[model samples]
Target: MAGNVTVDRTIVRAVTVFAMLNLLVTLNNTPSRSWMYPAGLGALGCVLLTLSVLASLRDCFRPVPTWRGIRVLTYISLGLMAAHCLTVRDLSPRDYPPLLHACGVIILTAAAAFPLPTGCVLMGTYAVGFFFVRLQSLTVGQALTECLVLLVSGATGLLLVALVRRTVSIVSTRSDLTQQEARATARALAQARERARWDGLVHDKILGALRNAAAGDSRRQASNAQTLAREALAAFRADTHSDAPTALARKLEQVADALGLECEIDIKQDQISSEVLDVLEAAAVEALTNVARHAGTPRVSVRAVIGQAAALLIISDRGRGFESQAPGQRAGLKTMKARMEAIGGQLDVRSTIGAGTAVTLSWSHEQPSWLTVLWDVRVFAPMIAIGAVDVILNVGLGLTRPARLFIPWLNPVLAAVVIGFNIAIAVCPRRPRLGWMLAACCVPLPAVSVLNLVTYGDAGWRYWAAGALTPAVGALSFRFRSSLGVSCCVASLLVLMVSEAILGRTSWAPVLGPFPVSLGVALVGGMLRRGLDGATAALSCENVRLAEQVRQAAGIAERNAEISRRRTALALDILPMLELIAGQGPLSVSEATECRLLEAAARDNLVAATLVNDAIAASARAARGRGAEVVFRCADNAQPHAGLRIFRSLVEQICATIGAGSSARFVWNGSGRDFIGTAVVLGHEASAIRAVVESVAHSGLLTVTCDEDSVLIQMRTH
Candidate 1:
């Protein structure tokens, strides 16, 4: 609808503007007394054109427009303007410029089409309009000149319009390509995360169980079975959201709860983008999973904060930390660092053997400052400026013999010094140390420059000499361990050598003496002042380090204080579990609740025990309907002594509560140090625990053997 309206408006405006221009020409050319008719017609035409242009603009801006409507509108406007031009030719009150008017109308109409062919159509229509105007006004040479100007104007306008349209097309295409890339990357990340989840489950559960079974530890074997169920739960939770950011605290709780490990999280909602959150969450889970598998640590804390311009995330553990930077030992740390950088973050880590480890990730929002601007200026700009000066001075002074010999030796030495300084700073242990390193670096080049100046009596040698001494004197003010001394001596010696060399050689003595003396004196004097600044800079570095150490020490103390408080809170939680185990009196409600938790915490985990029980009961009842021999048994060897009673009670309660009429047998047995038993649920409820356990018994493993939900089994044997 809007497209149709815009087309109408453009047609109206084109007609109106063209008529007004034509009527003005007629009035100007005809007798002033009789111009009223032409002016009135022109006024009417202007109104029509204005209305049409507006309607056409409105139409083009919207999404829906019928192909028929577009064609009808375009041809109607073209035909109307063409008819108007033909009727007005040689008929108005004055000579009419019908050609220019018609061209303008055609150009506007062609624009209404809105695509590649728009420009070509517009050019062709304007050409016909131009021919009409030229046929009316100009004679011979004037007509030819007018024709050239019209051609230039038409081509220039269309070329500009074409360029603008194509540029927009290219930009839109690039934007679509970038969006596709992001989508592809997101899909790959999702697949990788899914695989990691399954791998983690297998490692914690099946592998651990098999390892324990081989190690001959009955406790670990039972523990691994429970661990398997817990890992399955964790994998399920992680798979819940393939792309959305999962809460760090929630994910840790699920996995830690499964492994019977305690997790503490301090994360804020506004700390980072959702993308960063997902990355951190995955890394945290993986780290905790490793701890559960190897560290033997019962608890860990994960803390995260959004600094002024960076996001800081820390995962700390009170486990056996390894030696810092030990070869091949800290692959996880490397992985964590890589993850941080992938999200435009930084990782700073501190750890100690036997104490603990803190993996801190700092993510910057802005680009690195050095990379953004300063590094280029500090390193490249100077080299460029120096190179330009060297090229000009060396070429100009090559005519002199001494300059040829001296500059070659001096240039290489200077180049070596600059390269070495850059390499040293880049490889330096600490970034701030670059200040002193750069200052120290300034001394050597100046010494080489001064040596060359003394050996060769070329004025061009003065360029290298002066350039070298400047950085040296400037570097000394940095106040790190008498930085000025080496450069100062070099400058002083150059001054002495120049005085001797110039006094002995009288040929170019007048030209070189003044410059060498002035530069040498100034350098020596500047070095004296910098010697003091160098001392201050050295002291400042030490002070800064000490201040930093104090700040860090305070942070550690504060964290330790917080840890102590959390430990106290954990102690309060564990108190109920302990009281229940003591059995001094009837357990309190809280104590009874904690007892379930304590039972779960005793081995790999009992958190998944409830789910395991549900699945077992469901599977067994289904299997026993076939009336095959079957038994649901609690294995005595699953856990020894104390824990054996808890597992037994749990199994017995499950059997009694899930009652179904079926004939089955229960057997009690002891294997080595383990109290084990088997309940055989037979007939219709053979796999069902209720039929097997007609009487109650307390043990760990509840194994149901049945065929198609129907079976028969031994009533007892222990």
Candidate 2:
């Protein structure tokens, strides 16, 4: 309630200033002795208002007004004003110039200090009393009109302070929520980078050696590569460093830029280990370097996708590609394979003689980070309620000395019973029914323990019920869900306590006395039932989440199997054809061209199976056939977000707008919180692409920027 305090200070300061000016007037009129009595009372009122200013200021200089003392001081100022109003018939004491106005300011200031309803009662009652009490000296107009103005002005002032307080409180709450969101975003990014780092480690060390061995023409060279790969895997975990996905993203971008390569980098998650990040970074650098060397025009695209338990990175180039098996040309690919093998990941390479090249790295971790779980805050509500009830019991114990003296053993026996149940609750690995049963057993403990104490003293039956019902109310409310039940339980508890005190030591009979207590206890039993239902609801929600996860996992597994089947079918088609061409003597020029085309298409199709979404992949293939160079990336989501409908539609429009030999880039879900639901599409014909969308009925908001040479289309869904 910082906002409340701030408004309070402003009110106090205003009243204080008025008091100071009033004090000056009081001082000027002091020396006249004829009207000493009224003059003396007026002086005291002014002095009291001034003292309120000091107390309010002192409260500010120290800490806060958590106690009732500061409130009492403000009321004292109000009281002196009421007394002065009773004594003096006019606005101020005979010669004192309008001290009542200053008193009015203090009264309103006091009103602001209290809650509105209570403050209105206090300030209005005093203001009305003053006006009517002084009616003997006041005109009818003065009594009615002047009193009305005073009440209205005071209420308006209070309203203004409350408005300021409420506005500040809302803004303060929103700022805290914003900060929490920002921190959560940062952690997600960090974890994503960690996962990427582990994948990278596999690429750099183990995969690299395997690639070299695969390219070897001799058994000796192949055997040496095997030895290196094995050694790298054996020492891989020991040699790995903490992954920095941010560093990796930055370095990859730098590598592309240094080579004058035109590229876009989209990394949505930084959830890989440091070692994996390092490996992936090295691999990305190597792939980009390869683009600079063999791929003409040096154009590349790098993207990283991180998920619940797995991650993938795709480094692609649309420049002129080379044959993978060409002498000394497969060095980078060999190393990538070795690194992937080293860290228990996989690397797949695809290159076409003139089509393009794409390097795909895929990995999954056995244990996902706990931060990845989406936990509900309400999961701890029951625990918080239980703990709060426990603390309240302890506090009430200290507050209760008379009850303890009545039955000296009452305190220790109840404490031991409660503590014993506490231990029982703690020892259970899971939330057990026994714990709820034990708590139910402990709820009536106060009345039951005091059975023997009834004869010891005359604190009355009210005293015993006081000990019982206070705890009964708290314990019942701990988990009670029904508003009606809680109200009834509380009402019954109050009635039982009062009735017990009335009965004194009279009769334990009279069914009415124990009737309400029984109803209250039954209502408390509903707490146990409510808790059980809540637990059941939580379990059901958890089951839904797990079921969804399982379904997604199964979909991914089936897709992986489908991809394996496609690769096998494609290999069966290409390998036999290549083997026939090689054995049937040196291939003719046309035969060699056919072999290269078959290989490139096969490789591209296989890479396409894993690295890109079908929609984007189909659009890319279509655009390529139309002679436009397009790079499409969508990372972080195995299934495209619903928000991407507008984005994908706009991207297709852009790809369609590109003239033959033109180029464009499409990026979705970039690295910042603001950019998460955003997609950027930029191209030389961007303006023409914007024109294509000018007549379309788009669902989300689109921002189109047409530069001199490039048109840019940005879509934001959230």
Candidate 3:
């Protein structure tokens, strides 16, 4: 949608540039006209055109007021140009001044800036007036031909704008979809990490304390167990409240002190998400923990740097470092890597034995490349197609009047050269260096061709080379740099002016009449390139802002979910057990053991809460009764509701294969476009589980595989 706005702005600016150039050329040729029957009316028309051009240029960059007044001025200017044509007298139409040339520019401007119905009405009105005016001075066949050319030019402009709008719409839709997908993925990962943290809390704190109280015998041991349970309950309740935001430097200092190490810290602050800060603090703590326990040295440092759309954090230590291949010795490091990747950040660990270790975490907003956007096919194709049509029309008109050429053989040779250069310009967007070189070589051809092809003072389309071939030079030059493009246009204009003066036509009409069209083409091309650059920058910044908002929202949602889960566990399981212990003296050995088992079962529900149904829970209970260990692990918590029904069916099939004295672990992971469920069972043949899994037919959305000790089932989600 932003891109569509950019396109619309570019079209408006382009129309303004072309309209001003046309008006300048018309003003230069007006006073020297020897064909106008009434001079006063012609001067009045010229003044009106001048005022309209000035108004359009003044408001080119502003978007308010909708440019309606400028459009009205342009319509009056077009009518005046047509009226000037109608006032011509005592001159054959073929020998008349090129008054209809201004009509082409006006038609293109209207078509680009106005809606279809209005643009068509304007073009039709101008075309009918021009056709009727020409009919008074020439045959009907010639008049019809000129009218057809005017209409085709207008149609070309309409088609070009339509194509640009369609392309912009497609790009905007895809960009929205991409942002939505990124947000979805970030939310899923945040939920998964939150759930994992809760699982660890339940197992290490609540469940461990329950098991200890069950096995204690003496009064002192029971007292210690009771103290531990009270501490665990307090910590569980405290975790439900959210953490207040803190500065990165303060957080790093806290982590380092907790791990019993002194860290030299350097940080530059910017607007960073709490989610990102949490990951950085966690990674720093893990790295410092390694230094305290295994690095055998206390020399460590932490550095953080924030930029416009990026961030970097590094944790370094001068200790006895281990080999890179043995990074898995610290499982926390792998976990930090996954956490960083979940938020679209990068983690790199560098180390050498007997040297030191440096862990780097970095993130940056993704941006589109300038070269790729500049050379987009949607923009380039239309320019090339329009240039080819210009060449065809110019060469066809030149060939039809062979007697007008001073050297008859030069027409075909010039045509061949122009066509070859047009082809060369088509590929210049890809290889700009070559394009500029070609542009430089052709800068002098327009002036040289005009000098050699026509006799002195001949005025019958003798400057066709400057009109036709010089535009290719303008097109190719603008693809590189702005200074070079302006230089090329001015150089050609001056050389053609000098050539016209040498040919004894000292008036500005010969130089200013045909060459402004080429100049207009160059300026429009440069404007388009600049507009694209601005659009790319805006799109990149918008994406970064949207990503930050999504991450912040996900962090808040995960916190709320954790609070709800903790409340449920406290109300249903832990509170009743504490009440029983308070009423009686203490839990008996059998009752304590039963309480520990129930807590362990509740821990399972905390880990894979979404996968728990009555049938699955009943099967797990039966398996535990038969002296089997059953565990459920879910690394991705955002599962689609539609997939849950199918996941339940497939899970039921796997549970049927579990037998006595067998340990089973079921893992659910979501990555990219697929949802994978893995079942690892020991003390049972894998082929039986695989066969059972495959028996449930799925319509190409599910696949099952079995290795020596595991049966893996994968389902496609997108």
- Arranged by TM-score with the best first, the candidates are 3, 2, 1
Q: What C-alpha lDDT, on a 0 to 100 scale, does residue 362 get in candidate 2?
A: 85
Which candidate's lDDT is highest?
A: 3
lDDT of 1 by residue, 526-569 (tens): 33224223333433444445444553454344434444442353
Query: Cα deviation in Å at residue 288, candidate 3?
Result: 2.2
TM-score of each: 0.36, 0.36, 0.68
lDDT of 3 by residue, 1-718 (tens): 1335666677677777777777666666666773554657656766776677677666666763246545866677577656655666566655544445555576656666777777787778777877777777767876766566456556655665665565455555655775888689768877866754555445444554565566666564465456546655665556532354468788778757755687899989787655566566666666776677677787788888965478899888888888897664334555566566755688889988778889998977655332224454456676567666766766665556444456767777877887787677656454667766777766676676666655543333466665566447545544665555566667777877787788776645555555666666566666655655555556656666776688678867886777677767567657566445434445786678666666657656655666767677667766665667787766643454556666667666666667776777776654324555555666565787767656664556666666776666666553
Model 1, residue 337: C-alpha shift (Å): 8.0
Model 1: residues with Cα > 4 Å off, grouped in runs: 1-41, 57-122, 128-153, 156-191, 204-225, 228-247, 250-264, 270-282, 285-301, 305-312, 317-321, 324-356, 360-718
lDDT of 1: 0.43
| lDDT per residue (tens digit) for residues 1-718 in model 2 | 2334434444444444434444444444444422534646756655665675566656544433332334655576567666655565443312322344455545654576667787788677767765765465556654554465445445544553454445445544544454455455544443433333333433433343433343444554445445444544444324334334465667777667756788888876656665456566677777886787778866688898855367799989887877776422243465565566554578888888878988898888754211211112243334334443433444343335344345666556665665554444334333334434544554454444445353444332323333233333333333333333345344444443544455474443222222332333234334333433333344444444554455345434443444444335434444344334323433445444444444333333322222334465556556655666665443333234555566566656665667666777665663334443333444466567667767543654666666656665665545
Candidate 2 runs further than 4 Å off? 1-39, 66-73, 90-97, 133-145, 160-195, 198-207, 217-288, 291-718
User: Residue 538: error of model 1 in Å?
Assistant: 59
Q: Looking at model 3, report the run of 10 residues with the lowest lDDT sum.
A: 368-377
Candidate 1's TM-score: 0.36
Q: What is the RMSD of candidate 3?
A: 7.8
